[model samples]
Target chain A: MRRNSPLVPYLFVLPLICLLAFVFGLSLIRLVEFSFKQVRGIDGPWIGLRNYELVLGQPLFWESVIHNLKLFLTIPVMVMVALVLALLLYERLPGWRIHRTILFLPYILAIPIIAVVMKEMFQFSGPVNAVLTALSLDFMVLDWIGSADVALWTVMGLIVWRETALGVILFLSRLMALDESLIEAARLDGASWRQRAWHVLIPQMRGVIEFFVVISAITMLSAVFAYVYVIGGGRGGPGTATMVIELYIFNALIRTSLPGIAAAVSVLLFAVSLLLIWALFRVRRREEA
Target chain B: MTTTARRSPTGAGMMDRRRLLQAGAGLGALTLTGGLAGRALAQTPTLDMWWWGEQELPGLQAYLDKAIAAFTEAQVTPMLQDTAVVISQFQTAAAAGEPPDLQYLWNGIYHMESVWLGYLAHLDGLMDDGLLAASNHGPLSRFDGHVWRMGWYPLPMPWYYNKDLFDKAGLNADAPPATWDELLAACEALKTAGVEPFGGGVQDGYWAEWYITHGLSQNLDSVGDAVNLFIGDLDFREPRYHQHWVKLQELRDAGFLNKDMASLGLYPGIDLCVNGQLGICSSIGTRLPADAKTTNGRIGCMVLPVFGQGALAGRPVVDMQGMGIAAGSEAKEAAASFLNFLNQPAQLASFWEATGWIPAASGFDDSVITDASVKDLWTRWGKGDPITNITNLMPGQFYEQAAIPTGQNIITAGMSGEEAGELAARVAQEWRDFNPDLVEKYQQWASELSAG
Candidate 1:
């Protein structure tokens, strides 16, 4: 047990290493296997690549790819908006704690419950429409999610509303840990507020922001299920306007029950998630440099 | 430096004590489990059951307790443990190769698919047993040419209306709506009386029920009930669905439903009706709780009003619901016995009272039907009974292809009613494309079983 012996620390972390290798590594292997092979019923009559060909050739898969791109765009906007909000809250103004607490409240709400609440508030006969009706603005009371034209945007709005709070909470804690002296020093040098934010604060918060952007993007992609299921009513309908990649994967599971096709969709989704993470990481690296 | 060195020894001692305590807890847990195994091995046989139920779940427990005790006295020592988890649990169990002995499966194309996938055991032997013959009876038990699963209740879909609201509106109580025109008139009248004419459960997939009961029933002869849905014979581009859509839009425009109905769910919408704020809605023909009855002492239930069918329109279309034993169960004997017991006439009657289900079994006492005020509401339904839902006649995959997507589209206005019908026909085509061989196999199996 020499002081510099690497084996001591390696032995201490052996259980966690085994856990990651078996769980994540084996899951990746199975996903790849299912993507390549033919999925039979309880019994096998394997016909390789046929299921993949069937899925990849469909127009809907491409449609879903476009939908996923829209979802991917939300991550940067969400992070930026949340960072701005957190910076304001961190200014230590009157009732700053109350303001921060209020903004962070929605993060504590379960996704399904939030989805339900949002649906009620936005539905045709709900308070939103009631307000429109009372003010004689009935045209504005058009189907928020029911029309093909605005369905995707409506869903994006809901996701942004539901998820921006998570970003706020993350950045708030990160901002609190940030040194105030840096901002003070920049201000003493006659730097404008924008200069201080861009040069001083953002530069220091680079790693934390990158971490947040990647995790939030991943969550945004996978967590579309709640909106798709509750608001879209499980079909991602209104002419498949709200049909995102996760929904397409769900359709393959429920509508077709073809695990091969479903797994293929999962593989596509997995690739997209990795690409998004890589892109954000590259951006953060460049910023840091 | 001397004080810090002294404190390190105390900190190390505290850490050691905590580790020892954790080890002691682990040892105690292991000892308790080892001790309990011997006692558990010697105890009475315990079988677990799972199903979704309403407030009547307590009544079911009481009934089961009595029946199981009688069985125990007759030398069957099995005890039952029950739970109510959602349907997703069944799918998970199917994937994992372990499931409860009995489960109440929503019988549809999904059940048929599960059967084909060999997720269900063939229950022919259970049906053939003398005990089952003596005890169990119901329409759902006999399907195609075989006994698939046993059921005790008849949860037929019916239209419910508030009688007090109708009386206040000065509508004739003796002549309830039998056609679309009359139903509209009644709604119009109720609206004038400052009542919401219809309690729309729009958020709870209420629009699905409306299409199935009213729209499909009006076009039943043209579509041939649920069967034509499978075969793609119904044309929404035809005037049938267009007319219904227009009627729904008219209702919405005229404020026949509550202001926020599209946002309201089933339970909340039903609560509104129960609280006397709304007048009418379509629901199952089961009894409502005491608080849910209208001012006339009962909520009125009727067959869906006729639209295009003319004089034969007032007849009720019976919607059926039943249970299926999951494809995988280790305790097949135990589950089958429970099913048989539930189907017994006395037991079935008790279940009917608890659940407000109509008798699926024949030869129940007339008092069961006659004594209830809600029964009076179902007079037309009882006499001119037409049974089936639009999706029922279709192949079991009708749920996936037609029912789910078409309903969602129509309500959302993603597609017009006519376009939805056309899309449904196309979906039916896909079902044929996918399951051609399986369909042939099922048909052949059915024919062979019928001949035998």
Candidate 2:
């Protein structure tokens, strides 16, 4: 058993490569194929680019893309809050370990569980409104998940609340692994705590920050289905107000039985996500340079 | 002597032979056990049936279990999925050529969609034995000159009002409103009495469609006219359809609806009606018993008030929930047998008694439904010209992209009726344009219906 043998390493990775190629690669290929053709029950005559044209022509599809972009707005807020919290914890605050565990608790909980709890709390007559009414802020007691004007923001708030935990854990690990000498040198140079954090710690943690932002943007684009589905009550309403691209794809596939259009939208979504990630990396490279 | 025996070559060979025989016997026993298990599985016929919303019906499971048990040749395995996703799952399975033996086909879009896609087997041959009544093979169950599916039950949407609330508002409980003006007066009176006139939620978008369809169906001349409107042959921008929304807006403006109507779902809205917070709630027949129970017999149902002179004046919107044999099913005979057994009068009677759903098969003794409200429902269903829900007749996309959203806009977004009607017309036109093949197919079907 020569450890450095090229054949041996290739053999070791063969199973995983085969599995990925079979499961994901083939499915993607099939999806693209289906996108080009009209799909009825199981199969239909080929109708090139018609599905894509129809999908792109839909007002609802653009509405969903806008909704996804609105959701993406929460990523910066999430990163900022998580970074502050992680930096504070890096100072060894009282009960730091317990605080860190508590902060990460929501990330470990099941999404549906969190979604259900949040949905109940945000109902028009639920505890959140009740509390507002009690506090003499009755005017502020708006329909959190019901009103078209506010529902997307309410969903964004929920995402920020649940997703901040992952951000905190990511930033915390990076902060802990930072060179202490940099911070110490800044402090010895008579820099205040804020100055040290702003100049020394943040600049060092740029890579993790970029990673978190890209990951969050991708999640916002693709993985917010359950949240929107549950909170929007599956129709992505109060009249398509909370509809995201993923839910649109789901509706096209399941509800409308338009698999061709769904596949077309899925391909578009993949393209958008890739473009976003690529843009993020390009920005990071420029900043580094 | 033991030591000498151990060293003997003949003894050693004999022991070796015995060990080999024992190992062979063990292997043979294992193989025999596995073979028997596999054979047992192969011999027992398994029929996969997909259904949804059975949990809401109290006795459906037991009835199905008994029916399945009675079929000695085949065992039915029911897959209960969320109603929202059942059609999608069926389509996926059918496309893969692995569909269940039987699938629940909701009368309007589900049945028509599956039939159009050639995913359902024509069930006309199954009815040749007269297991299902000839009367049951009418429009709801038959399409394209074939009975594509057998009906399970037929439920019609009607306005169920809390009699107690009506009485409290000083309105006649016995004589529910018969005209739009009268209904508005009742709403005003109920509002003045500190009671909400209607309990329905538009948040789910279905309540809006249900309300609009209920209104429009009454304004249509006939079921055919309604179907024509749904298929884009009749313009939705017509004043008749537009007026339905205008009247709905009037209801909203006058504060006759539940305060949180836009935020509540169907069950919650019905709960408000049942708990006596509102005077009226519109729902299908299946929810009536529960309404009656909650109101302690204070609940009564009526056809929606007529807004104008239309063809379907006294008709209620009746829709069917039925089962169809999958086109790809290998056990078609078994599936048809189960459907026939379920359609028998005795079974229908049992189902009606337990669930209060009107049996699809005709000639079932009506005496089984002894509840007064249920009896009233049955009578109404019989007397009314049976028009299908407009939501059911339209393309599924129309309901999602146009009807629901337009209704919501009218109710919540202050969208004018004219605007809503125009939007709806656009959606219908787009659907027809986008799916030219389906539109052509529906036109052919409609022509055949007229010829028949």
Candidate 3:
């Protein structure tokens, strides 16, 4: 068979390139334009760096940033639990297939459905608290979604519960593709399970681990809107306790109709995401070298 | 010579006659077709209408359908949307200069914002049919001395007490609390009976508006004073406004509010009230009878207890649910005609029967109100001492960014009322600074309000 010409390949991909330019490129340009203007109703007028100043001056914005940073604390716990579960499944333990299916179920569930269920379960007088009280663990009963000190952590716990499935699926696929003979050799050499995990299995899965970390960070930074919105009752409150950058942007845009400030905050969030990705890549490059 | 030219069979004359005959035939056919098309277009004008809140106010869609059927001059297309999506949809339509001919407005921040943006058409000449009393909806329907929207009904937020709970606490079930001190004493009695005295959701944000509006009505003299306070003429730092927060703090400290208020939304709070967990709750008058029925409890409505002597004592904060014609609509006459038809005595009475809401129009038959609680509400509404809700009179930013959040902070973070009041004032000032144009427009409105 004859190969296609180089021009044909470029022509075939031209539509995709055009689509990306029109969708992503144009939106980014418009977003930047909107950030430097005062948008009232439909039209906006140019106003310079005033929107940025206003956004930065808001204490709520800083609080949201702090909340996003706190959510990142869940990454290590999620990764470790997922890796352990995947390793156990790799051992071919009884009911391993059923466990794997159960573990992956939450990943496929819709965010809004999960958020709503979790919000109900974690209410002050909800089933979780009722169970605690019934079990005579009265001291442990808490206002899970209401207290300012506890709401953010509760949201983070929910994120970890829903997101650990993704990590498990990724690690399990990588574990399945591993060489069986290597594990056998390690066992024959009298290496314990923990030692094998530390020396052989963990080293083999470094690339996947790095990829999961980056993706998790990105999700935490920009894609926790539904969780925060539903669980926080759409205001990211009990006094802005669960607020994140996305919620802040939504409140500014939809509730306050301050598109200029929302756009400014969005641009800042984009920068933060870029910085996070860059830092991850730099760390991965160092490890690879 | 003329006779010869006229009778001659020359080639040029023959050609001229043929061209003239062809032109005459073409012109006649064109005129006939144009006339038919114009008549067809005039007979069937298409008008687009968009509305929401049909779920909460059942039978709204049925009423609209009947209205459309009754109006024979135009074909009305009704687009029903969820409450969350309607505002954004209206904004997009307004931007495109092809807004629907008619839209439902909750007549406060939303209506005023649209009016200020020139998205709403003024109904000066159209609303002069004497169908609605000027005093009932005059404050809400008119902005800048022109009617920008036609009010559907006045929704009064009055204090509702469970008569059973009142009796259980040894308080009079027949007579509700009439003063701030009496309300507090009732709360104390309810607390002694191991019951929550008041139920509302601070998490939903609207409860903040309810509290502030209740306080303002008891503290301010007129709607203009409330509007002035909202527009930053009378700052939130004023002692009168600060006193409202102090009163709220006293309630919080007294353990009168529900423990899970910070976690619950409005519906959950309503559930708590209906379940007898709450002794008292503030609710819209339209929802009182239904809420009462759900609880199997006898409920009574009263004005929010006056904290101190003020001009608006015994008045409840009322907001109007209404309709506005879009500025960009092409079928203005047809839309106005539909509105007039819908406001007729029979149709308005039918609406009252279906929705169980007090009608804004005057000629509706009062016999349609069968529910005793609703009838009592109508009697109170007839007294004509209602004040506009602050949420309707203030900017959206003030409520969403400043007041709601500050109220939440007071509940969750243990902030002092003084601190919350100061922060709220700062936020309001910041909003004014950011939107100087809106401030100027508000000042113009204030001047007109004062002159009147």
Candidate 4:
């Protein structure tokens, strides 16, 4: 009970540790248990691995996994755009504060809100196509969100637009903290803006860039549900063209009443996310070193 | 002149301690007299009702609020559920042994899964036989000689055609196309008149479901035939089973579908017909009042034109939303009593007045409807020999994976009707593989529905 005792500190934090265990620990155990059973109405007879087998056998599950993989393409685009925008803003360009707010507006707004707006804009007869037709570019007008071939790409565009904002904020913070003397020395050496960026700014921003890329990878994998849900008509539709692993799990649990299948998929997604988290830790450790 | 009235206890914030003491003493005296009422008001059976409808059918909450105040059978506390959680929330709570006494029920497999899980009480003994029958609780609500739901409001599935567009195309608006070929001809004429024809929004995927609701039944001999497809006794690959999608493909191939149909939602798609931008779109009865007014009685409702050789073809389709007692409820009798009370004549009329939509009870008086268009719709789709919506019988797996995506793919992505059938069959097989436990229940349900 003494203030200086290590046991006292452990006691002080024990409640929080126990709370975390109860909140997350207990549910995680049940989730893994459910994954091994045929769950109905919160409990069911255990039929080990049947749910996982069924999930793996279904082509729809594979389709969803492929779609999630497709979404990974957004990270590189997000990184490049965010880095360029951050460098421009870092130069203290005219009205950089206003420009920063404008760039970050998509991130500030909720995903569903921006997604709804994007859905409206990208509809076949929506304003975007109307404008395209109004211009001399009639052939460029395509069914943006309606066609199965184009819907996922449209979703990718939305992901990049919104998620790059976080990268911009992160890279700009890192850029501002960089040694200005190094950039000034590059300028005195007659390096161009692109050269200075590639040689001076980006090399120093490796840690923040890696962190942003890792975080965005996680978002693309598990956090794009709202975008796909809103744009793909709440069922990952226009023929499941936008079906992602998150939506696949959602359909299994809520729509199809197959909680066991949902749990199995959730476990897989959790495992994949854990790997990404490990990679993130390695990056963090190296950065600290 | 009225200073005493201003000083009355009923006036806002005007009560003094003396008046408070007097009011308390009055309440105490009332309680003493209330002993003759057989039970203290506090001891009255409390029923918890979790419901959902106001999101789809506005003013439903107001109607239920008024009815709850009017009923004397029990103390009812109604909670309006979110649309997405109506089933899962009830099932989860029921599994945890704390379900609401009464729960809202969507038709067919939506509630049947809960029934199979033993989460809902059968209404056969709890509800009056005559009243329950008159409630039109549909074949899907019954299984193993027990009924599990009491019908609340009916959604008469109708296809709306723009009369103005029809007349503009030199076709008789009074006589809508009654066969598949006639429908194609009508669409051709409408297109010639520069009007989009024969499709609605499928962007939200509900349009696709409604399409199946009307179209699939065109080839079904009974509601059970639809269930048989999911149970694996029947197959969507059979030409007759998927003829409906072929008809949709025919429309698409002929350019009868609106250019933007793939990007619109069910309601906005219906708005195309109502606003005269398109020729025909699938719709529900609840929208007729506003739509009829918007079009000044120029909107026409009809069954989808027939194509397949089946007993159920050319009949109107109506889907009902209902209520059921939770199996875990402690106050089952009170909940049953409240349900019976809702089916009474006055409550049915109040339902009509509050929602301006027809109650599902056969006892509902149709004369209260004044709009000629609405009356026509009710007379044809509601009062005529109507088939229950077969789309309601689809297992949730089939519905989410096959039913919705098939129509969407055919319309938006150039998927052939045969391809749709293949996809549907595959999804049905997948559903069976995923839910082996529910398959036998569906088989038994199919047999009962077929027998009825």
All candidates' TM-scores?
0.78, 0.91, 0.91, 0.94
Q: Can you write out model 2's per-residue Cα lDDT over B1-452, one digit (the tens) per residue? A: 57755765656455577888999999999999999989987887789999865755667777677777666667789878787788888887887899999998776666778887778898878544575553354464557777787767776778888898899999999999988788889888998999978757677777887877688776676555655765777887989877888888877787787767767777787778888887887887888877676667788888788886787665677766777899999988878878877877777777766666667777577776767887787787754566766566677778788878777767666778888788888888768756777887777666655454
Candidate achieving higher lDDT, 2 or 4: 4
lDDT of residue B315 for candidate 3: 78
Among all windows of 10 consecutive residues in model 2 chain B, the one with the lowest summed lDDT is B132-141
Evaluate every candidate with DockQ and list the scores.
Answer: 0.16, 0.48, 0.41, 0.80
Top candidate, metric DockQ: 4
The collision pairs in model 3 are: none
Candidate 2 Cα deviation (angstroms), residue B388: 2.5
| DockQ, prediction 2 | 0.48
What level of docking quality does candidate 4 show?
high
Error of 3 at B380 (Å): 0.9
Task: State the fnat of model 4.
Answer: 0.74
Worst 10 residues of 4 chain B by lDDT: B4-13
- Candidate 2: residue pairs that collide: B221-B311
The weakest ten consecutive residues by lDDT in model 3 chain B span B129-138
Q: Model 2: which docking level applies?
A: acceptable
Q: Rate the local accuracy (lDDT) of all candidates.
A: 0.61, 0.80, 0.79, 0.91
- By TM-score rank, best first, the candidates go 4, 3, 2, 1
For every candidate, how close is chain A to the native chain A in TM-score? 0.87, 0.94, 0.96, 0.96
- A1-289 in candidate 4: lDDT tens per residue? 5789879978989999999999999999999999998989899989998988898898999999999999999999999999999999998999999999999988999999999999999988899999998997899898888899999999999999999999999999999999999999999999999999999899999988888888989998999999999999998989999999999999888888888999999999999999999978986888689
